[model samples]
Target: MDIIDENFSQDFHCLVYDNAPTHLKRTPTAPSAKKMTKNTPPVGKNWLVEVNMYDENGKQIYNSDGSYKKQHVQMSSSGFTEDGTPQSFYFEPGHEREGVFKGMAIILEERGFKGCVGRNGRLAECGDFSQGCVTAGQPDCCCRRMLYNEPDFVNVWPRLEEVANARGFAVLFLPKFHCELNFIEQCWGYAKRVYRTFPLTKKEDEMEKNIITALDSVPLETMRRCDVLDSRFRSL
Candidate 1:
């Protein structure tokens, strides 16, 4: 499948942007207790988690106003059952998608993605712990599900300069979780519908031919319509 279009080079800039938008089902993991208890105090239900303020030299950190700085707190968590049973487990805050993205950011930086800037105008840097730090301590209930101010790409950002200088490509990351923005997705739907019309027991070569024909059969006008719709939604 070669698409040789002179216009591709004539009009298009040598830039590319993509993201591996992974998703996970958010199953209800709400802790059992609803009210404040010994384990479920005002801050949160997570028993092992606590805020311990400290300075760069490991000394207790305090603000100029004689108050502890929440940003410099030592956060720790332990793995235990919902019933408060003791378990031998260390906290893994960067598990699952967060973990993968953090590693990807580090790898991209090492591979010449250093010094890149994001679309949001933030310099490519590792996660900023201070950005999400609380200004003051509170009980678990008051602090439960608190939103932190932080960049969305803090976990998976590669530097922009290194991408252009080292890789000679520009990147444009799309908004997260918006499939309507990608016209190819709509084209794929049309192709899939066409593919389903073929006989199920087709031979291997015939299947390949059918698949290719189905993909090519997508109307250009339909593709344009998808783009228009996407633009309309973005305007909203």
Candidate 2:
């Protein structure tokens, strides 16, 4: 937008391609850890178990002199807290039940975000998310799937479009799940491969040097090649 405003008179278009969670301004609130009770069996999914070794006398084992000896026993799915509630419970009704998506939607609506075009190609206006939406598959319920499909023009996108429009430019979004057409993905993969080639080291300074070296090693020709390849694929 800035470059076009400064150098060109004709309107320009900004095309954005995104798929990963990194692009979302705010992520969905994570579920509270499942607590384990005496009667409740161990959990299995998404839980880690940590055990501390103690001597026969029931006291925590210590190192030879003063340091405490600590070792990771194994990863377990056992319930963490006694109750289902979070250990440090900050009960945010919206975030707890519906997740951060509702909170994000509320914030956006408050800031004049009217919501985005849905898969049906209609503007899905913001609703009262303080009370969570109904689950999908029910009669007209705004379930998790629907919420995900809702248009999001709150953060980076709205700002980008606003700036571009003010400078006589149009902002376009690439089709969803079309990463193969994005040349940047190939460049990122190439960069990661280069980064992996660096010699493994423990020193922080050495690691930083290796990272910089790997990034700087990607030639401009390689970037051009990636873009050309992407164009060819798109044409095909």
Candidate 3:
């Protein structure tokens, strides 16, 4: 971001990344119904999402033994409803179970989706949680499925995008399993080929030097050609 501001301040920038798991990961507290209970908890109990604790500096907190310190926090709001009212995952203040998770059934009920949990309604989830509804085109087959397909739920942005948008930049994730569309992969392949030609060395320092030299050996022309090929593929 600093480099972009320093060199290309006048132009809009949108960083493109491949659909790697790390790149697609959302913040731990991001709104999600994957683990939410079907109904509200028992009296004196509450449901919360477990997330890694972070210090004031935004760094993850760790225990003395190096394990991450975990804390339970309410998931963020599930975005606004069609009427533009903010939808919170937990019940509002002054309610019987104030601040407790509303559960999938209640959450859906507020969205005007009724009969999602009782005998006449769908189950908490279909037989295959991953496959969702028993048949395609049956989004209301289950409570969880209904919530999963909700517009707000489906449109939750990844953490990377949130960070980039905060800095006045946009982010786009390339299609998954399409290496030909990501020119950087070709650059890495070129670097590996160059590395293979260097003298074999088991020493850590020499290996590091060879790797740096290999990466630097990728020509500007080769990078441009790879990018052009990717652009052509995208157009197709």
Instruction: Give the TM-scores of the predictions, in the order they appear.
Output: 0.37, 0.37, 0.85
Ranking by TM-score: 3, 1, 2
CA lDDT of each prediction against the hidden true structure: 0.42, 0.46, 0.85
Model 2 local distance difference test score: 0.46
Superior candidate under lDDT, 2 versus 3: 3
**Backbone collision tally, model 2:** 1
Q: Report the C-alpha lDDT of model 1 over 1-236, residue by residue, as the tens digit.
A: 01313335344443323345332111112121112121112232233323446678979877799976653111211223334443222223664322111222222223233322233322222233233323333211121111111112112234443334354344444476777666678889999999999889648899999999999999999998987786677557
| Model 1: lDDT to the true structure | 0.42
Models, CA RMSD each: 20.3, 17.6, 2.6
Error of 1 at 85 (Å): 54
Cα TM-score of candidate 1? 0.37
Number of backbone collisions per candidate = 12, 1, 0
Candidate 2 lDDT, 1-236, residue by residue in tens: 56656777464455454644443322122221222111112232222234456789979887789766666322211112323422221213553332112222232233243442234332232253224444323322332223343333112244345555576665444457888778788777887898898777899999888778877877899988987887777667
Predictions ranked by lDDT, top down? 3, 2, 1
Candidate 3 per-residue lDDT over residues 1-236, each given as its tens digit: 88998999899997879998999999878867788888888888899988898899999999999999999888887666546688888889999888998888878877788786556666887886686566645778788888888877788899999999999998878999999899999999999999999989899999999999999999999999998899789778
**In model 1, how large is the Cα lDDT of residue 21?**
36
After superposition, candidate 1 runs with Cα above 4 Å error: 1-6, 9-18, 21-131, 135-171
